[model samples]
Each structure stands twice: as structure tokens, then as C-alpha cells.
Target: MTLPAKAIGAAAFAVAAGLSILAAVWAASAIEGKSLRGVRAALEEGGYTWAEVAVDGLQVTLTGTAPTESLRFRALTAAGAVVDARRIIDAMDVVDPSALGVPEFTLEILRNGDGISLIGLVPSEGAHAAIVERLGDLAGDGQVTDMLETSEHAEPEGWGAAVDFGLRAMEALPRSKISVTASRVAVMAISDSAAEKARIESDLRRRTPQGVTLSLDISAPRPVIAPFTLRFVMDKAGARFDACSANNEKARDRIVAAATKAGMAGKVNCTIGLGVPSPDWAEAVAMGIAATAQLGDAVITYSDADVSLVAASGVAPDLFDRVVGELESNLPEVFSLHAVLTPAEASETRDGGIPEFVAILREDGKVELRGRVPDPLVREAVESFARSRFGSTAVYAATRLDAGLPKGWSIRALAAVDALAHLDSGQVTVRADRVKISGTTSQPDGRDEVARILSDKLGEAQGIEIAISYVPVEVPEVDLPSPEECVEGINAALTRQKIEFEPGSARIAPSASGTLDTIADLLKDCADAPIEVAGHTDSQGSEEMNLNLSRSRAQSVVQALMGRRVLTGNLSAVGYGETLPIAPNDTEDGREQNRRIEFRLLRIAEDGTTVPMALIPGPDTPRPKARPGGSDSAEPAASE
Candidate 1:
């Protein structure tokens, strides 16, 4: 429709521009609608819905967030897989890395007879193999069930440390269920005993990581107290409860207050126990403890609901009766009372129907108590006291049940125990009102003290016999002389006496008997000393023959000593022959001396060290080795 030149030119230019725009549009659509779309579809289908692809002209671009760098790279590779590797335009942005919001990581470990179980998430950096190996070692023959997942994301701060601490705690708490998280670990378990519970708590505290929170709930049931008991004793040392039990704090408070009024001096710990007869347990115990205190030195005990109140021997009968009446009236409905006013400590006033209590002290460090014990509680208290005071392994109580014992028996017994401490060894017999203590002590006033304490605890009319004797200081033992001293003594004695032998023969002449007798006398004194009768010979004959002759002569001397009834237990004869002559064999006199028989004091020490004690044969005993220096009867056979 163009008519002019300018019109035609503009129409042609507009047409060309339209075609160029269509061409660009076609190219853009081809990449975006096909290749880019295919890439996006592939990413989405490949389980990466987070990836987005876009296109401009021939360039393909990626957008949107990638959870991790690996996924981000994977999107690039995915596009490259669909088209030319150079065509992939990686505009993808990875999600910003931040600390885990809640770390909300969890782990549970269960341990039982069957095995150990590990179930939960674990950090990727955690060496799973090492942990699994450690678990396997702990598992031993037992099986281990592991169902754990690891996160690619870096662990939150302190996460690794918390898990490690949790694992260590698991080893210590074998019978526990442990719940571990990045920030906290909770332990639930049962402890076999109080000691075990304390051990577990200590272990967890020591091993738990500093930044992690730990909660431990360990349970241990109350120890059973059979026959449920209470024993409160009042004396000069002030009032005390050997064992106290209360059902509740209210009851415990009341009982404690009453004991305090009665002179309880130390930290009083009353056990809170179950099975209290009634809610009024506190009232009953308090009233019982208070009433007994008024009667003077007393012991109030409870065996289940059966309450026993015993007063000292000298408690006035009227006062005892009034106190008992008041206690019975004030007691709870479930309680029953048994009251007794002990007879005078005088033996004549005591009932003869009940047997006495006997406690024996043995040299073997054993203390035995038999006869009567007031009640189950008193019995247990006494045994415990004995075991603790004397020795846990050495004390034995064989006491028989005898609630019929005289009123003041327990008091006298307590006094007797006090008395026993002063004695080194002894026996205590507690009867109706009489206490008989017999023992030995180094303290001068031991007897008086035993009597004094007994009288003090039992009051007037108390018959306390102290058949105690004072032990004098022991004398130091004399130490026997060492082997060296014995040797010195033997050598000196042999020098004084010399044996004479018949010419050329091993026989000792009759003239030698006097010398033999003298030597034998010396031997008698040093019977414990080891004497070596060494024979020396002059070079008068062949060395071998002289050696034989001297040996025989020495044997004769030994026989003479034996004949004199001297102990030869330690005496031995050894012939030195011509080897160890005291004098030269050259001159007559020197040879005469050389021919002489010599005695050497030999000391064999504990280590077998031999030393020749050149003894003067002082005062100590002497023992001889194999030797013959006399022939009292005739020629003696020689052994060289």
C-alpha cells in the first residue's frame, strides 16, 4: 500500500524489524520452553524440587535455593546432561548456612540382659565406626541394635561433646535408660543400693560435658527394718536413740523434741520408715520418751506396736506408777504398754526367776554375749553397739529372749559395757541387780572406776563387784647373743684345755681325760653355740697319715664330751689335717704346737655368712662341728 519512496522505505524497514523480533522470540522459546524446561523437569523429577531454570535467547539459567552445595552443583550437572555443557548458566543460589535452630537431635540407648540399643540421629562429623566399635566391645556376647541417621549439616555447637558424654555415662549406668540430645541427657534407672545410687550420681557428675544439661532419676527402696523398732537410752552421757523410726516428719519432730528435752546432746537422726502403726506414731513415741525420762535413767523401746518402758533400779515405785499411768492414758488407740520399775540393784531384792546375762571376752579378740536380752529392739541395738564398739568381725551375740529380766538389767548391762572399756580382758555377768566384772587393766583406779560407773548408772543398793587386777608394766625381754658372741666364747674355752693322744695313734690317752672333762664342762655351758673341733697335725709323719691320725684323735674328744652328757646337737668335728697348722712343722716346740688340736668358733649367720669368731669363750653357749678330741674308751675310728 506504499505509494511514495519514503513510505515504501519505512514499510520495508518495519517488516524487516518484525521478522527479526520473531526470530529472537523463536530462539528464546526454544531454549526456555524445551531445554530449560526439560532441565527443570529433570531436577524436579530427580527429587530436587528446589531448582528453577530460566532462559534468555540461547542462554539457559538456574535460580532458586539449593539446600546444600552438593545439590547446587548437581543442578549444574543436570542441566549439562540435558544440553551442551557450555550452555548451562548456573545462577542458582544456595541457602544461607545457619546454626541449627533447635538442633532437636535425639538419641535413645537401651541396655538390658539381651543387649544394647542405639537409635537416633548423629552428626556427620562423629566417627560412627569408632562409636560402633566401642558399642560392640560393651555389647560383648550380647547383641546391639543400631538404627541411626546422620545429618549432612554441621553439628550445632557442643553437640559432639554432649553425645560423647552421654556414651560414657551409659557405660557407668548399665541398667539405665538414657535419652541423649544435642543439649540435654536424661538418665532413668534403678540402683541396687544406696551406695550404688551415690556411685551413679558421682559418675554422671564427673563425666557430663560442661555445656550439656543432665538429669538423673535413680531410685533405691528403703532398707527393711524387721520387727520395726525404736531404742532410746538415757544416761550420764545424755539421752540418745540407738535407732529411731518414724512414719512421717511430724511424728519424727515430736519424738525428737521429746528426746531433746530428755537430754539428747548430739545430732539425732531418726529414720523415716513405712508401716507406722498409725498416724499418731509421733504422739505415741513422744509421750513414751518423755514419760520414761521422768523416771530417771531409763530405756524406752518399741517392737511394732508393743511399747516397753523400763526404769533404773532405784526409781521410786510410786513415781514409776504415776508416769506409767500418764503414758498409757496419753498413748494412741493402737498402742499397748508394758512398764517395769527395776528392783533395787541389791542382789537380795532381785527376782530369782530370771537368769543373768553373761558377756565373755576371749584372748582371740572375740566378745560373746548370751543369756537375756530385753526385747527385739534392745537386742538388735546391743548387738550393733557391740559389733561397732568391739570389732565388726569379732563380736557375737547369742542372747536369748527374756523380757522377764529384772527392771534394772539393761541399765546394769550398759554400765558393764562402760566398765569393759577399762579392762584389757574380762567377763561381765549381769544378774538381777548385781554386776560382776572381772578383768585386768593397767589403770590403777580401774576397779574403783568400774564400781563407780556401775553405781552411778544403777544408783544406791547396786552391787557391782570389780574383781579387777592391775597389770604391772611388762618387762623387756633379754635378747640372746648373736652367733658371733657365741663363737668368741667357745674359742676361749678350747684354749684353756688341750687333748693328749697316745703315740702315733688316733687314741686319746688317759691323761687327756682331765682336759676332756674341762672341755666338756665348757661345752655344757655353751650348748647352743656351734663348736668346730678342728684337728691340726705336725709334719712328723706322712701328711696323709698324720691327717688321718689327727682326725681320729678329734673324734675321740667328741666321744668323751658325749660321754660327759654334754649336748652335741650343734657340735660338729672337721679335720683340717696338716693344712691349717697353727705352728711351723720345722722346730720341735713349733711342731709340738703345730701337732696341737685347735678349736675355732664358727658363726653361721642367717644369710649363711661364715665368720671365725676368735672367741675367748666368754659366758655364752658354744656349739661344735664334727670333731674328735678325746678317746675316753679306746682307739676311735677316724673320718678325714
Candidate 2:
């Protein structure tokens, strides 16, 4: 085996290289085994019961579900820290098995640039606090964004300790003295039964807790009265009050007894009537007639007296005196010697041709008269006699007669003027008794004709006086075009413009200039009418952008119209944007058809009708954008 020194050195180097390669392979195998064991142990310790761990060389990969994000992070950190592992890849789901059935309690933990966000629902306030505390500990210096919600459920006991609540309701009224129960309480009172019941119930309910109920019962006493009866009768002939009558005494005794028993004291009335054994019929009749004549309406009999009178309409007061005097003279024996005649009531008499007249009886028993008089001679005589006899006792009772016409009398004149005014221009003023007509018209002959017609129609009415005056009537100038005419004009303009609107956009091609010119002419012709320039867009862009574009387009149209001498103030611009897209935006053709600009007649003063003017395409030429080298082009040049 002995050889030269160079040969030995070369052989030794080859052997050493072979041994170094073998040792490197053995170290790699040991590190791989150690890393696998470390990962497996970490997953098991972190409560990832279903996880599988694998390690290759310096890399550790985890595949499993951890109970919480903290547990997953801890497991990954532990695996990466192993001496053999250079990198770690975690594919673990931090999901709690208990929270699977409770979607509301499930939480998602996300780490953002700013902080950690916790989003989910908790079972209770306690649960939420616990979650926050646990996450706060894990977060350390990081902020936790909590978007958790509370679970709605019945509160546990002891939650209302702040409120002083008692087991039983406080006793208000006594129980035995009154029928008392949970819902209802009853009481007895000798007086003010209703008031006492209400007061007690109110106090009890006010003191009662929020969750309690209440009811009330009361018993009231009845009023006492003394029982009694009375009887009386009317005699065949007559009845009168007599102090010595036995019937009167009996009635008085009964009344006194009843009053004494009922606790009342005062003057008590008692009725009396004649006994049975009637008087002779012939004597009764004669006495009755004599009494009637004396009393001016009274009856007299052997045992009774009654009075009655037959009044005459419009009879003079002197006639009453003569009749009374005659009765006194003829029935001196039956009538009282002091028989008197007095007017029962005074009243005014009303009849045709005679003003309302009132008669009075003087103190010396003479007649007096006052009121309106139909004849001068009669009036003078009545006034002089009344002043001489009654002095200042006479009353004025004159009646006012209405000679004016009724309310509806003016209706006839109104009808006549209305008919005539409809046919021609004129001003008519209606008064209580007459109508005045005057005003001028463009046609003098038409004014005269209207005045004649009104006069003829009103002359027949005797109640209303018609006064006709002819003057100039200023008619308002009717230069405004009708809605139909305006619409027709707008349609004609649209027809001439060959280029129709592209659905909703206001962009018009070069071909539409002629139509736009026609529209300008129509607007100029209908200067009085207010035109609304509306811009509409398809539903392609955002609502806000579309709205702005529409508004800008509408204003552009208004500017163009103004260039043609159309008053800008008369033309208002409105943008409906994509809200009122006449055509659908779903298809390319439909989108192109939805965008348009339209001129609408908003108002017409002649007939107060609003008509849509017409939809006309704007200039279809694309607006030039900035280009390189200062050249005008439709497309914008690319920036450097």
C-alpha cells in the first residue's frame, strides 16, 4: 500500500469528499423528521383535533380547523419556531365547532391595515364582554374593531336590582270591611258612595306596580219617602173654599199627617167640592145666563157660579162697555154690584188697506186708538180722541209695507246682459233695481247690436230697470297660438330635420339643421308660449353623470334657440336624465334610441293647455377634443 507523498494526498482527499456527502444526507433526513414531529405536536396542542400536519425539509404546512384565531396563530408560530423549519404556510380555519349551529354567534376576525375587525353576534351581554376581553388580550398593542350585535332573549333574574320591587301590592282599603280580591275591591259607604269608591280605587292603582291590574265596586243607599193618598170630587152645581166645611177639615188633617211623617212643614192646599143632591135645571140655566152677562162670560146657579165670554173680532172698546152696562142693568139681582169691565189683552189689528192699528182702554173706561192710518180724516179723528182719552197710554203700532222688488228680480237683467256680453265685448254692472251696460268694441256696429238686444230682453221685466250705455270695450289681443297649432308647427319642424333623435342623447347630426331652423321659427312665431327644453339620456352611465350631461345638453339647446332670437327666459331647460328613458337601454339599438333632446310647449295662455313641442336631434358632428400639434380632432391625443 506504500506509495509516493503526492499519490497519498490525492487518495485521502477523494475519501474525505465521499464521507462529507454521506454526512450531509444524514443531517437532512434527521431535520425533516424533527420538523414533522414539531408540527404534529403543535396542531394537537392547539385543539386542531381533525388537522393533518406535513413537513418537507425546512418548510411546514398546516391543514386543519382551529377553535379560534388565537389558537391558529399560536400553532403556526410554534411550528415555524422549530429549528428545522425555515417557512410556515397555515391553511387552518379558525372556526369553533360549538358556534356552527349558531350563525348569529359566529364571528369573522380580519386583520386590516388599520386594525383587527371582529364581526358577528353574541349570545348575551356577558358573552359579548367575554369575547372583547379575550380578543383584547390577544391583540396586545393592536386595536380591535368590534361590530358585534346582541342576541334578543329574556333577561335573567337579578337584572332589575336597581328598581325597588316588592312581592305583594301594598294594602290600601281594609279587606274584611270591603270585598277585596286581586282584580276587584268593593266598599260600602253611607254617603258619597261613588266618590269614595273612585278615590280609594285611584289611590290603590297609583300605588300598584306597572304590571298589576285593578277593578272597583260600590253600593249606594236608596232615598226614603213617606207613602200617602188623597181623594176629591167636583159637585154638580158649584164648589168654593170654606173654613167650616167638614170635607176641608178632613183634607187638611190628612195633608198634615203626611207632611209630619215626611219631615216637611208649610202651608198645604186642600180641595173642596159640593155634595150630591143637585139643583133644578131651569133655575140653574137662568142663573148661569145672568152670571155670564154680568161677568162678560160667567155662569150662575142656585149652588154654583162660572163665567165665560164670546169675543168679537175687531170690536170697538165702546161696544164692550155698552154690553157690560146692559148686563149690569139686566142682571142686578144675580150679578155682584161691583161688577167691572176690563180689556183682557191689547193687540194690533191688521187688514187690507188699513195700517196695523191698536186699541186701548182709558182709566175712565173710554176707547183710544194709535198706529198707521189709511185715510187722513180717520187718522186725525183717531189721534185726537186717543190723546184726549188715554193721555200717554197709547202705543205706536204702524206696519211697514215693502214696495221694492224681490231678490231674484235682478236675475232677469243678469241673464239678458250675460247673453248679450257673450255675443259681444261689453261691461255690465248690476244694481239692486237696474243694470248698467257700457264698453267699446273693435266693431262699433256689434256694440250697438248688443246694446239693443240687452235693452229688448230687459225691458219686459217690470221689477228690474235696465239702463244701457254704449262705450268702447277694450278687448285683449289674442296673438298666442293654440296648443294644436303649436304642436303642428313643432311636428313640421321635426319632419324637415331628416335626422331623427338618437333615442335619448341630444346630439344632432348636420342634417338636422334645417329642422332646428324650423323649430326656431316656430318658437319665434309662438313667442308668448313658454317652451321647456328637455334633455334625456340612456341608462348607461351613473345617474349623477347622466343628469349633468342631460342638463348641459338642454342648456346648449336653449343657447342655440336663443341665437335664433328666441327669448332665453321663455325657454326653460330641464333634464330628466335616465329616469325617463323613452326607449330601453338593454340593447345597443335601444340605447341609441333612448337618448334625445325634445322641445315641449309647457304652457299656452290662450287655452291654458300644455303641449309637447317635438324631439329634434342636435348637431350630430362630434365636438373636437385636444390633439397633438394643436390640430382639432374628434379623439383626444395620447399624453406623453
Candidate 3:
């Protein structure tokens, strides 16, 4: 008890150090005890008893074994919370429940503020939603985020309607979206483009569904334009002509008056032609000379200014002449007076005299002489003389006129010459014996000269007979063979076989071998023809299996044909399978017949020989029916 001050201080320090050590050890033991209790509680709840727990101060550690990774995680988590652990060390081994013969259900929950996320392969939409709702209930007011994956579980028989209802529900929300995973459908929405995308989303959503989720990402518009073309053609007559002449004082008056009467204006292009000068030949010539003197022939010939009184609307010849007379009286020095009429004798004569001929001179310096003459000889003589004088370049034959009369009659008479002058170049028409030749000539008196020649010739010919003749031309026709005939031949050959097959099989029965032999003969007959062997089957069994079987049957036929010495290259095997069945498959016999092989002619040579064996149908025809004792039935002879 009696000690120095320093020793007393040292003793007090040692006691305090021991107490601190004891407290540290006790805290460690308490932490370990709490961790063990938490671990035990977690293992019991999770149905695991083999797991171990340890603690060092605030650090908790889980060890040993557990039923699964989930169980190990749960044990550590429980221990950690109780010890208020600063750290958790996991050294536990997880046992796979599948390997241990235990059913496993995986649950994952994610929370971010007011949003929650869930993800796992679920059996159905209802189960997935139920899990989400449970999590939501646990989270209380926090938003639940779901990213659940699902197995492809088929929707129940009547659940399609329920799925459609869910789709409708999703459609109601402007930002709602729905998609299927496995048999389960997930729904979510959160943007402004959701309403438009809803229609697509609604189509995809299902209460009991499976497969990949469908998404709508549409965000743009389209464009349009008008369709057709309008067109028109100019009339170039009537009102159009009136508008063109409206500026001219005299011509405008006439044209405007005509247009007003017709009631058509401003709608189309008008074309006008200079009409015949005048009804009175002598008067017309006099008027023409006067107009030519004042306005020059070019202006007078403008078509509009050359209007004839005979063609003028609302104006009689007498009235027109009175107007002309008054103008001539006032401007007598500007106009000349002369008879536009031809000489009286010349008018009466069928062939006009020299004076009458001069009066018909056109403004362009050309004249047209038209009349009938009586003598053929005169016509021929004048025509010959004119041709000799002018050459073929200047004199053209327009037409020939034949008046019924004795043969070899002179064509040079007045009647014959008149008729000759009216013909068009190169035109020839036969009537009776009298021939009137007419055409344009270099000389105006050519017609008269021809008439005189005809008269002289007619005097020589008393009586004779002649016959008309013409040659005929012929063309040859080409001959070609018909495609239908060839196709018919092939069909006939097939029909002649009269072989039948069993349903869903390509095995040709022993009975059908005779038909095959006949087919072989047909092939031999068409040695040069290229053939296509095709196999067809009725719609039965899986598509893949049917196609394979058809191909095998077709190949088998090709092999058979090749064995018969048919050229391999000439024959080609093709399997159409159910695609080209010739018969219906709804009935037993129909299906039997439908499962068959056929040979078709692809091509033939011109010589009808050297047929390519490849073109022959393979022997894969129809299989015969099975006999009662499992023996194949024999096919009848092809001829029978």
C-alpha cells in the first residue's frame, strides 16, 4: 500500500490497460455470438443447416456450405445486419438445387428511388405481374421497375381474348407499351410518342403469350401529287379564219358577219383558202385586172382580199355588182372596165376557142382546160405530138376517158378532146370502146389538136371488136406444227398406260411394269426427244419428308431409265412433291392417283428422230395395289 507517486501512476495505467484488453475481447465475443445467432436464424428460415458464421469486431464472415448461392447470400446478409458489420466476407459453397433434386425459383428485385426493376424468366404474364405486385407491396409507395424475362409458355385456349383485353388497356394509355416474352406479356409507357405507338403496341400485347417483344418506333409523315395530262388540237377553220381577217376593213366586215352568224369565235385556229374568182368569167377577169392594177397581184392574191361575190354571206350577185359599179364610178381612173365573161360562141362550144382559153388563166400563170371530145384517134395524135414537143417532164398523163363507141374510133374530136383535158396525171379508167385522153399539158391548144386527130381517125374505123385483159399476182403461205398437238400426244401416251398408284407411296407394283414397258417403248420411239421426269406427291406427311420422298422416287425412275440404256443426259428428274399433284387428295383414290411420276417432252428435233433419252419420263409411274396376302398386284398389259 505504501508506494511512490510514479509507481502509483504506473499501477493505475497497467490496470486501465488490462481493463481495455478485457473489453476488446468481450466485444469480439459478443459480435461473434450475435453473428452466429443471425446465421442460425437465416439457415433455419432458408432451410439450410450446414452453413457457418464468424465475426471479428464489426466485420462479419459466412463460411461452410449452403443449398444454393441465394441461400449463402441470405445467410451472410442476415449475419451482417445483426452485427452492424463494417464488412462481410463470404466463404460459403453454393449447392445447385437442380443437382440436389430440388425445385428452384429465382427471384430478383431492383429499386432506384421511386423506380423498381425486375428481371427473370417467368412462366406466365399473370405470375410475372403477381411477383411485381408483391414487390410493389413490399416497397410500399416506391415505383416498381420490371425487366422480367419469360419462358415461351403457350397461351391457354381461351386466353387470347384476355390478351386482347390487356392490349386494349395498354392502348388506352398515351405512353403505354406492351410486349411478349415467353407466354408472358410486359407493359410499360413513359413518353409523348406513346399514343401513336399505342396502336402497334396494342396489337402486340397479350395476357398469355410467348416470343420476342414487338416495338413501334414510327415518327414521320408522307407526301402526294395530282395524276393526269390535258391536251388539244387547233381547228384552223371557221371562227379562226374570221379572227385572222378582223383587221382588214373589207375582208373583216365579211368575215366578222359570217362569224356572228356562225356564233363561234376565239376558240381555235382558222385556215382560209382563196375561193374561185367569179361566177361571170368575163366580169371576174375585168375585176381582177383592176384589183391587180391598184393593189398589185400579190395583195389581190392574199386570199382574204380575193373573196368572191358568189361566196359572200348575205350578198346577192346583183347587190355585189352594184357595190362594185358604184366604186368603179367614183374611182374610174383607178379601175378598168372589161368583160370578165368568155366569148358567147366559146361558152356554147364544148371545147373553148382561143379567146375562152385565155380568159381562164389562173393568177399563178397556170390554166386548167376541162371538156369532153368525140374522136379517139385525134386524142392519141395530139397527146403524142404534145409529148414529143414538151418531153415527159413538161407533159404528164392525168387520166383517160372511155366513151362507149366502136373500137379504133378517132379521139381527136371536140367531145373527145374536152374529156381528155379534165383528167388527172397517171389516171386511167376504162369504159366502152371510145377512149378520151386527158391530162395537163405545156401548151393550152393541146386538147384542141388532140380532138382534131381523133376526128380524122374515127373517119377511118368502120367496125371492130376488142377485149380487156389484166394479170393476177399470187403469194405463198407458211406451215408450222401446233404446240397443242405435241402436248396432246404426251397426254395420250400417259393415259394409254392406265396404271394406278396407292396412297402416299411411290412404289410401282409388279402389275404396273407392263405400263412402264409401254412407256419405255414410247421413249424408244422418240429417241431424239428430250424428256423431263417429274415426281409429284399429294399433300401428306411433313413438307420436308414429302419433298425428300418425291425426289428419291424421281431419282429411282431416272436410274431405271438409264438401266434401259436411255442416255443419262437426255433424261432429267425433278421432284415437285405436293406442289404439282394432278389429282385431288381429299379422297383415298384421288390421293393414290395424285402421288405419281410423269414424263414430259421438253423438245424435239426437226428430223423427228435422234430423240434424247433424257427427255423420257422415268419409270417412277404409279405403284400397283397390294394383294391380300401382302404380295404386290400385277399390272395389266398396256395394250389391254
- Model 2 has an lDDT value of 0.44
Off by over 4 Å in 2: 1-480, 495-508, 603-640
Candidate 2 similarity to native, TM-score: 0.20
Model 1 CA lDDT for position 332:
88
lDDT of 3 by residue, 1-640 (tens): 7899999999999999999999999988887777667767866676656776666666666778776566667776666655554577777887754566312223333343445566555446555654554445444586767777543354344233223333333434434444433234445554343334544444444322344233444331211101000001012232212112122234334533443443335533221212322223223323432432222111111121222211122234454456456435543232233212111221222443221110021323333323332345545564564444434344433323435333433333333333333322312222232332433434322332332333234321211111111122232432332433433454566576644444455555566666655665555444334456666677988776777677667666655554454333435555666766567889988877777777665544343432223333336744332211121111111101
At residue 433, what lDDT does model 1 achieve? 51
Give each model a TM-score: 0.42, 0.20, 0.19
C-alpha positional error of residue 373 in candidate 2 after TM-score superposition, expressed in Å? 96
Q: Which candidate, 1 or 2, would have the higher TM-score against the true structure?
A: 1
Cα lDDT of all candidates, in order?
0.69, 0.44, 0.42
Q: What does candidate 1's lDDT look like per residue over 1-640, in tens digits?
A: 6399988899999999999999988877775688867787788778888877777666787888888788888878877888787877777788766733534667788887548888877655244443555566667799988887666565677765666667667776668788887779999887877657976797687657778899999876565544456767665656766457777677778888888898787666566656666777787888888886887677677766777777877778889889999998988898888876666544432545447778787766688888787788777777777777688898888887777666766767666666676677899988875577887876543554555465446653344455667685564644555545555555565566557677788788787777776666666555555556666788877767877776667776666676676544355565656766667778888877776766556564443445335522235646434223321221211111
lDDT of 1: 0.69
If the candidates were sorted by their lDDT against the true structure, best first, what order would they fall in?
1, 2, 3
Q: Which segments of candidate 1 are over 4 A away from where they belong?
A: 1-120, 125-149, 156-161, 179-186, 203-216, 248-254, 274-279, 346-430, 433-640
**What lDDT tens digits, residue by residue, belong to model 2 across residues 1-640?**
7799999999999999999989988898888788788777766776656677776767777888776576677776777666444477777787755565533233334443324566655446654564455445445587978887755443233221101111111112222122222233233323234344555555445544344233334333321111111111112222211111112345446534433333334443332233312222223223323333333322112221221222222335666566546644554233222322323433323443322333433323343333333445444554454444334454232322323323543333334334333332333433343344443333323333443343334432211212223244555554767755775677566544533444345555556667777777777656445556666678888988787777667766665565555434445566667866666789988876567666666533223323333322237744332211122111100000
lDDT of 1 at 295: 77
Query: In model 3, what is the error at residue 225, expressed in angstroms?
Result: 87
